[model samples]
Target chain A: MKPHTLSVLVENRPGVLSRVTGLFSRRGFNIESLAVGTCEEPGMSRITIVVIGDDAKVEQVMTQLHKLIDVIKVSDLSENERVERELALIKVNAEPGTSRAEILQIASIFRALIVDVGSKSVILEVTGDTEKIDALEKLLRQYGVKELVRTGKIGILRGSKSVPGSK
Target chain B: MKPGAKILVESLPREGTEIIFGYPGGVVLPIYDELYDSSLRHILVRHEQAAAHAADGYARASGRVGVCLATSGPGACNLVTGIATAYMDSAPIVAITGQVPTNLLGNDAFQESDITGITMPITKHNYLVKSAADISRVVQEAFYIAGTGRKGPVLIDIPKDVSTGLAEDTPLPEKVTLRGYNPTYKGHKRQIDKAVELIVHAERPLIYAGGGVIASNASAELVSLATLVGIPVTTTLMGIGCIPCDHPLNLGMLGMHGTEYANFAVMESDLLIAIGARFDDRVTGKIDTFAPHAKIVHIDIDPAEIGKNKRIDVPIVGDVKAVLQDMLSGLKKNNAYEPWLKKIKHWKQHHPLRVKDDGRLHPQYIVRALSELVKGEAVIVSEVGQNQMWTAQHFCFHHPRTWITSGGLGTMGYGFPAAMGAHFARPDVPVFDIAGDGSIQMNIQEMSTVAANKIPVKVAILNNMYLGMVRQWQELFFDRRYSFTELPPVDFVKIANAYGIDGMRVDSPDDVVPALKASLDCNGPVVMDFRIEREENVFPMVPAGAAINEMIGGHPRS
Candidate 1:
């Protein structure tokens, strides 16, 4: 499968995610992962979509997105010139208090944020690259992880310049 | 000379286009007016999308740049789907769009939008004409970028003001230079030697060819290489005519709907020489498991495609025809695979394509009859549906560029306009479209274009009264929950008659040949609707989510 990243500029309105994602489902090209948030521009939102397809076909997908009325701009960043990250939260079993200290020590090594605590369970949030997040999640699995949620890949161009030849 | 439209017209010949296909709208009136009585000939199409497909069909049929024009905003947007289709298939087309005046571009004025910016990813290159002086040179560069190595579509957006403006004598650029656009043509000698060495040592070797053969006109080299080494050749859908179907060494098509013998041969082979064919997921069931037994030698013009799917033992990056020539020169002719060929022939004989033995008409039988009736000489255009796969599975195309289908994009409504373009290129030869009813309805507007131009294209719509392919899957996997697959039958004969064309519908098997002949005998365009079996599924199907070779055929049931 081809890996494609789409940087979308939207109007930060309600149901915007559904509109953007609905297009992909309608076209049979599914969104493998998606990230949306407020951008530097107020009232504007940036959505990062990592799709799987051939480079040429991915370009076609981006074109299809730009055709949508809500999309302001779409960019496919070069791998070397882009920075990517994601976040994950996991709730693991603490073995009734015996494994709680061990879990905290391991979480400290990975710099995971402890969000919730109980006598038998603890929730930890980890943020990093896909690989780092996966590693931390695997380590937590040994403590009987109960629930897990992950934010997909989000990317932006590193340099202080927009895509060439576009405003 | 006139200002806006006239300058754009002058830019035409410099870009190496003698003709363009398009339709006019209010926004593009200026360009249409200038087109009249000009050196360039613009063939008016009934729909804007046909203009794009016609241009693409022209480019693929004849190895030159194809051109199409349209007005903003719906006319321009109509070209988007077809443009994306060409972009996916890598066809060389220059699409010129007429936009609203510059003042109204950003204000959401009538018939105004940013078309050039919208088409950025779908084109190899694109430009916005801010001034009339840039028109000629930009057109020159658009042609250069499109027809150059790894051909693709390009866009040129002309605001109404620039198209009608004049500024002194304009000069077309002699050459175009792009900082990061370069394609390699020559193969490294080390990789070539390594490939030859593997071929010499392998016991069961197979050659996988793709559309690159047609792109490079490398059929002769392909035939010679297959014959020289005595190896069987299996082709992808786009690679259909690289070798004669009757050639003893041909294994037919290999893919989702490919023949049983072809898929078996690919999986059972020891050394796989993949030339110009990417290991698409559709072609190779699961990437990690595909050709697991074979040592791969991948030869392609695009370097990025080499190791993207399967691990490569020998990656020879070069044009297919050129690389094959170098390999042929270095290797000695050997007929050592006689035993291997005999084994494969036994497999092919035992497990050939089978339809129901009943008297009902089967889609594959129709394709076989059409293939035989045409004597494998005419260009075959196929609509996107089960009919397309049936044609690929049964039709024995003998030459490259003979079979045209929307392979990459699989766009319905592609056959008629594409056949129109193919006939435009080779008028002396016969051209026919194996159309599906659902697909035909998508772009039936082209009937007028066919009739007006007097293009004799014989269209055979496999009228099952439903989306046959999707219905086939729904029958087998989705518990026959036919949602939107069924269509309220429209009288295609009346539809054709309304367009001033002859038409007929055949319900019995005996009428198939006669109906075909009747359509071909008519002086102009004709449509023959064959009311085929509705429940017939494309057999020898590879069950979805299964390995390529673990088909619903010969293998033990899972």
Candidate 2:
């Protein structure tokens, strides 16, 4: 089974999200990762959802999503020329003198920014592909990471031609 | 300038809403007051559940948006199952509910329930009208959404204050545009061509038609396409009357309770041209093995159903009638299926739908007798399960919208209320609810509505004294451990008499015909209770999860 990433355009209406998600649950579909944001089109939102299932089932989910009234359009953005980004924040248990310098040096090499400083911890913010962020978090874990957070995958279609909505 | 209540009341005739099935209570008192003065008709049902079913039945029978209303809390909650039933079956219905006053909302005031929240999963779309001025537009949109695109139920929740308020506009908008909701009415030309290419080449093509054929009024086109292509046609339960039962190519129902010949035809066919039918589990049985040899061409207005259950070789997503018309217009007339027809005829001759009629009284016999008396001109609604199966097998249905049943949801007690709905839609036609003892009792209170409204519907109860369908399953699969399937003996005729309707009990096979005749001869609603064989089971059943071809009980040819 391959994972299919669906880029869905929908009306920004109350309960539309619930309806879409509710449909998935009722139909016994699993959602791996999802991210939603206002798109280039006014009053419309773009939702990128990653679903892992057999080709037939994934296709069924896409077709069912199309039936929802608020859903404007749905496109599989997986193989399309598209850029995806995920943001991560990691707080490491680094003491001021003993490990702060080493942590800052390692973070800089990965182009991650040291967003916060404290006597007992260092907060590093990383914005990159999911794989890159995963690698940075793995390295940060060796120094006793306090906490880590990630905004799931958000992507857009490539080229100048827009994903049609109310532009 | 009218209050929102009056506007909502006035909106009925504007949309051609003739009658409403509803129950009144506190929050909707204003709306009820308005209804009292308006010329629009209302039939107060015993429960909100019946109201939704009646409305759904009305929609199915008349091809119009049926309307129903209820007050808040339990009233709206009762409509839940009915709405879900309609939703699953794609019945066009608009359900209105009165919410608590705007100021008291979320405070959990008396008789207040989050009805909009409760019905979100069931309705195609819903509205919570907080403003009085928005009443007209909301009504318009609700009707529009409910009656279009894979039509299903829609809900409108109006707070008491909105109905009572009196702020106004000059005129309701002539048009309302939903930027997101545009239904694809025309099939894609390329897809249609691909289907035609597949159809022209396949030797054993079968037309699998469903409720969508009736919903789209495409029986004419369906018949034309089947005849032109020289393919045999098999109908789903909801598609029974798409072609006359006696038609040469008609192969009865397909799936679990389907005819043996029909199931065999499906299994052996190389090409499956599915028109407006979803491949439900009942039809497919073991999904992996279902139509294993067939190349599928599915045409449905609902894009969701095109490849939802089974894989599709050619998917034309549009109205069934429109797409069928396109296919008919484009295809060259070719009768290339003589071999296929001969093979099917051989199977039909060998595995005809028959039962051991060692009849004291049999439900199938009664159904056949009733059909013969009516001559395929009556409207037949059935309660779900064995009775439904029997009617699907034996009833001589000849027209669209004549056979109505809750096929998708399989909701018991849907028959009588739905018959009431169908009666209202076609007052001149004879309506019969062929029900099982178990299913009829589910909403027998509707007898009150029937009697009061003087709806000339006949309730033919096959009194098996048990939940026969479930019992049959238990007997076959679970070693005869019948648990909770046996129903207590209740005299349905006496109950009907108590409801102020004439009724009779038929105990012998000889009485079945006379009982049916007497019931039909009555002026108003009549219940004919036939004490059918207690242990009889629906035959040609493909046991659950078994392949469609592996059905259990049709005798081989002599």
- Regions more than 4 Å wrong, model 2: A118-122, A142-144, B103-107, B170-176
Instruction: List each model's interface RMSD.
Output: 10.7, 3.1
Q: Could you report the DockQ of all the candidates, in the order they appear?
A: 0.04, 0.48
TM-score of chain B of each: 0.96, 0.98
RMSD of 2: 2.2
Residue pairs with colliding backbones in model 1 are: B3-B164, B4-B163, B4-B164, B4-B165, B5-B163
Weakest lDDT window of 10 consecutive positions for candidate 2 chain B: B167-176
Q: Over 4 Å off in model 1, which ranges? A: A1-167, B1-4, B173-175, B355-357, B553-558
Clashes of each: 5, 0
True contacts kept of 2: 0.60
**CA shift at B461, candidate 1, in angstroms?**
0.5
